[model samples]
Target chain A: MRDKVVTAAEALAEVRDGALVAFNFWGPGTPLHLMRALQERGVKDLTICTNNYTLRADVLREQGAVDAAILLPQTRKIIVAFSGVQQEDSSASVEIARRVQEGTLEIENVSHGLFIERLHAGAMHLGGIYSPIGIGTSLENGKEKRVINGVEYLFQEPIVPDLGLINAAKADTLGNLVCHGTARAANPVIAMASRYTVAEVFEVVEPGGLDPDTIVIPASFVDRIVRIPDDDPYSRERRVEQTLRSVKYRLEKMAEAEAEAAQGGGA
Target chain B: MKEKLTEELVAMRAAKELVPGDYCNLGIGIPLNCAAYAAEGVLLESENGVLGYGPVHDRESLDENIERVDWDIADAGMRYLEYVPGMSFFDMLTSFAMIRSGRLISILGGLQVSEKGDAAIHSTSKDDIASKIGGSMDLSWGAKRLIVTMTHCSKDGSPKIVRELTMPVTTRGRVNLIVTDMAVIEVTSSGLVLKEFAPGWTPEEIQEQTEATLTIAPDVREMEF
Candidate 1:
């Protein structure tokens, strides 16, 4: 299958004003090439949805491309709980937290667990997903709550985005993409949940090149492919970059800790 | 390695322990220094991506504009930091899970290790009034083997080696070895066995700093580099 091969910057041409753009990066498999392109284009007032607010702060902040966002409540810097890690504060999540607190940015909170189920439902083209992920608590606001199997579940609507930015280890002309072990976290889910998906790969190969069993994302859903340079070892430099990215994040935590202390140590 | 903090880092170079394929997380403080002393082959996984980052460039070389991570640069021998394009907070959290899920082979840091190996890192919970658990919950709970590198006690002559935890905990019963400036204490079911002590310090001097009990080896030798 013949396909168009463009730089990540070019694929971002589809992004329009007020568009709800979603990124598929989960930290390790970020589509930085495409993010760079969007930064270069200088798009404005984007409505972004993702698992976290990190990429928007690190990349999109340069272009003022994001005005509002939909993300897991825990993805914000001062979160109480999130997927896998349980309850913890994230420096990357703090950047968005600062913006939200300053009123410079607007955010919509989704619980981490419900966020995944909603995206999964969207990928499956389901109308809605019902789960006990967020029920009977403050997160139940404005949502239809019902009892099923003697358990309470919240009716979470499907999440669909106008554009999806993704990263992959390799891709074929047919759009089949493969990711490294840990890099595959959310890219496939984000790919299926978006209308226009652009993939940035470490290597671009032929259509029949990738193994069928190893294909993490099928080309049928992808709209574009871009290449990003993989020059550095996954070592201290990455840690440094992570460090720089989290300075603001750590400061936010210190501030939160101070605030929490002032409030008599109650969450 | 020299006795000085920066010089002891030199020992990390000679020890040549961190392997190339290993996915390691450096705790804050001295362990962060380990990144600079890390052996050539290791891949240090930060909570964020952009691996192989050198230590911060000279202030003159810095952009002088944007805020950067505290220890955001590596040394000259350090490789170029690769940015794992598009990775997000959730992604790092998952990477941390990989650590918490027993995926990481080894973790290095310093601590007040309870006899059960429960690490109290957030704070003593009595001093400064406020203490919160960060990623320490995952790090101490995860990691195949936990290495605590620090002095054996607090500044006010308080022992880090305790029978029970009195402060907020990062993890419970996760410590494997305690690498201190004075000695290497291994936590056993009975209690802490002082495996080695600093060249100039004695078991009694070491105990003076600790509030808990200490057992000295009959043939104590200098700490291995």
Candidate 2:
């Protein structure tokens, strides 16, 4: 069997300028190290499809955790699922808005499910999924619509990205992956949806070291595995602490609102 | 003459819809308070792919339910959660599958609801610089029953119950119920029916606040619990 484990820079070499990149951003499974690596690689004119377009980083930073913010110039276009959903006007989101206004970047916004379903279509090699998600809103524009079972549904097209950057808790030499918690999200799908898939993993084990039942992404779908450099085990612990702080912050705000309402006669 | 219901009360009213053994997803903002008031057996799901969990309010609760706590496992709103018994996690695709399959009842915070049951939970500016339509579309379209918990009026005090939606629509004719600060409106084919009003607020007062004409249910009464 070929050696699939390589350094982050070596794996990122496969990514070229103008590549259509895909990132699994819906959960803690985001390939943060790989994203930062790509930003360092300085690939230009890349069109990236992701769930959150740099919005997560800003939120994390506010909570005092160091988020891996990819500040790549000439990103060209971003096809995002959730943009400022929390109504958070983060610097990254603000920059995206500014870039759009400056005609420096283009963006395509789709609903969360359809975004994944479109990628699933490409991975499964099937016709695009017919979803009624955006049928009513302005999202109905320029899409093929059909009435299936007397209900109107829009046909979404498959999007096979040139490269998929994914994260995993562990990977074997043959590239079988194991993801932790909800972090398993999008890793399997992105591996199958992209032409070339590279993973940023916490650990690299020899083949057969991992039980077959434990592997989430099989070896065949993954092309390379890069163990995150200088991996700190305390990273998640710090983030958890920060999350608790934010929760306390929310509670404090709620109490203040309640106090204000009480003084205002519940108006 | 009387006070309006608080955001927490609106969420409490919405939580009544989540009986035991029901799977539920709550939107951000006021709807998030539904977690605190959810039925004991309710399985709370988040778009980030967690189910069978409850929101973690502070460190003490986290330590109490810390058996399988994955600190990295944050909810869609970026809130850390407590992993209760029977709690399991899945990927985003599977998470959304459950959402679009009519298994989860969603309580969402809406921007507006039309008389015809059309919901406009998402909004975007004309500049079209960036649009954020999260799981609102799927939830509104596929929830077993969609209940919107919001205030009756916008910050400017304009009615959110409207004759027609002027904002970006999320789903057409999908809202089953609306629990606002002033009243509980049932969206029917005929019109928006005023089912229950807050204490001291009458159907006529709600109708006056609403942009669309409200059809008062024959048995309308003051909201309880």
Candidate 3:
């Protein structure tokens, strides 16, 4: 098997301007190293397709670290399942909100299932999928529609991404990937759908060391593997600790503000 | 009948629809409260890719070391309920496959539901740039049964159970049952049926709050906890 190990910069170098990139934004599967490298590369007009575009604010608030470095000014469009704030007092990513207002960023909100199915269509080399999910919603505004069995269904075309940046728990020399726990999210499907797939793993082992049954993605689907360094701040344990500390800090700050308010009210 | 039911009572009433061994998806908001009231053997599924979840863990009650074993924390770092045996996690494709294949019953919250069983839950009129659809459209279209739980009226005193949805429709003709603070209604081929009302609420009172004309069931009774 051909060796797939490469530096994160080398792997990210393959991406160019105006490329459609499919990414896994869920939990441990977020490819933080590649994302930072992409940010450093400063590619423009990239369309990011993912489940949620609020990863930047979520991570910053929860972990006090930045994993969604891709949510920068260079991103011209986003096809996501969820976007914007839901509650009156709650807030979304300020940058994203500002971009949308300035007409610099375009967003298409699809349901989570349709988002995955569109990727599945690309992976399967099929034309598109027919589903009734968005038949009557704004999601169906410009999409092709067909009536089958007297029920209307929307025709969602395949989203063939130019690059797939995914994360995995372990990878063999040949780039066969295995994900631990819930980190296996969108990585498997996005890896198959993109023209070039780069994987960032916590550990890289010799070929055949990974159990055959444990491999979630095969070498054929992966073009490169970038092993994250041991001391990386994005490491699972470190991120968790940082997140807990940030939570405690925020709570303490809130308590202090409350105490100050009480003192003023008493005076 | 009682004047108005509590949110927990509304969820508890909705839980009565779940049968043992049923695979279910509970949306955020009031539908999430159904987890605590669900009957035994009803497996709960989360759209972020978890199945067979138990009741959500109380932050104060969680024993980090012991409870962490069976629980799977979501990507957002929110701890889900303890996991039941046979629980599994997969990628988004597999999770959504179960939803699109109609293998799970979906319980969701809605902004408005029309008499024709159409539901509008995703975006409000004020949201212009990003609609924030989430998984509501998928869950509405794909689930075997789509049960909606929400307050009967919006905070502005407008009815949510209406003759025609004023909000953007998430999915048309998908809602099966609606459990609200005021009443429990079923969407039938004939139209919206008022099956039961809160303890202090009469069928006439619920009708006054509802925008749609309701056909009170012949066997209608006061909601039981």
Candidate 4:
């Protein structure tokens, strides 16, 4: 069998223009290292699916942006479950809002549960699943709804992406992945659903270094692995900055709103 | 009139609804604070894939001991959480499976709730690209019990509990209970029933603040801690 571990560039070499890429981007599941490499690759007209669009815009407001979403200029649309601005005008978007206005971007809103279930179906090769989660909401729009056992359920379609960018805590030589803590989000599912999955791991060890019982993504599902260095700035330093910025913005916004409310009450 | 219920008080009142051994999930904003005031027995689930977590580290608490904040153990909201004895984490599939399968109860913040039990938590405008509908759509049906904790009115003094929701709906006709700043209302098969009110407010005053006409419960009394 071919070596599972490879350089980041080699692992991401197949990613081309117009590729359908999926990312495990919720909280610590984000494949930040690989996402940055892809952005530098300058791919275009791509359709990417992810959980959130930059975690409340802290990543997007900066010129560097964050995640693969920094590929906004080259990208065509984002199929996201949660993509929105925290503040309508200020601090939220210097990039996303412009794309929506130009008709260059489209947002496909979905329920969080059904979104993953759709991917679950994709990974398992199932036709679809009947869901009642968003039955009477906007998510029911343009979807086939059927009654099962006297309860209304909508049909959720499976989505298989061309490439998957996922993060795991560790990977062995055999390509098995171990994603610990809350970081174990959609990574395993993305590995199974995408045609070719690339994992960004903190470390790569010998085959037996990872406990077989704890491996979340098996070798057959993961195509390649790229280990992010322990001292990588993307791992901790950057998030600390982002978190501080987010906290400061939130506090300032709260203060402004409180001041406005006080003025209104006094009058 | 007495002091209006702060966000903390609204959360405290919602915390009263949590029972021992009940698996609960809280939305962002006012509902997230319920964890601080809630009893320890209830198992909390975060939608970004955590189950049976202990109290989360807040900015105020972390200000004293900043080292307690583990960036890796954060929820989807980026809040660092504490791990309890039997705390376990799973992928989003298992997380939502537990949610949609009615294994967890969801307490969420809201912008508007209709008399007919429709809730609009995510966005006020249907076409607003600036707001997101994260898991509220799924959380609305987490279980037979969906409790909404929010301010009685918007910051601009507009009534949020209304005859019909003018905002984008998260889910329709499924809100079971609403704990607001001024009143604790229940959604009965018949209509919205006002069960309790804050100390300085009467059912009449609460109704005045609400756009929807409220049916006062027979045993309606001042809200208790």
lDDT of 1 by residue, A1-267 (tens): 446568666788767766666664344565655665675666666665655433234343333322123232212222221222212333334545456667655545554344555667787899997755434233467989999989667788887777788877789877888876345655777788888889887688887788898887888878888756555322324433443444445456679889988898465
- Lowest-scoring 10 consecutive residues by lDDT in candidate 1 chain B? B71-80
Please tell me which model should have the higher TM-score, number 1 or number 2: 2
* Candidates by DockQ, descending order: 4, 2, 3, 1
Each prediction's Cα RMSD? 11.4, 3.5, 3.8, 2.6
lDDT of candidate 3 over A63-140, digit per residue (tens): 445544345667888888875433232234566678788998888877888888899999999998887888878888
**After superposition, which runs of candidate 2 have C-alpha atoms over 4 Å from their true positions?**
A56-72, A85-90, A231-267, B57-69, B124-128
Count the clashes in each prediction: 32, 0, 4, 1
Ten contiguous residues minimizing lDDT sum, candidate 2 chain B: B57-66
> What are the models' TM-scores?
0.50, 0.90, 0.90, 0.92
Error of 1 at B107 (Å): 2.3
Residue B212 lDDT in candidate 4 = 88
Candidate 4 to truth, TM:
0.92
DockQ scores of the candidates? 0.04, 0.52, 0.50, 0.61
lDDT, model 1, position A104? 53
- What's the true lDDT of residue A198 in model 1? 90
Tens digits of per-residue lDDT for model 4, A1-267: 788799778898878899988897776778888888888788889887888775354433562436545667777877777765444543436566777888877767776777788888999999888888778778788989999899899988888989899999889988899987899888888899999999988878997898889988899999999887666646555655565566656767789999999999899
**Window of ten residues with lowest summed lDDT in model 4 chain A:** A56-65
How does chain A of every candidate compare to the true chain A by TM-score?
0.70, 0.83, 0.86, 0.87
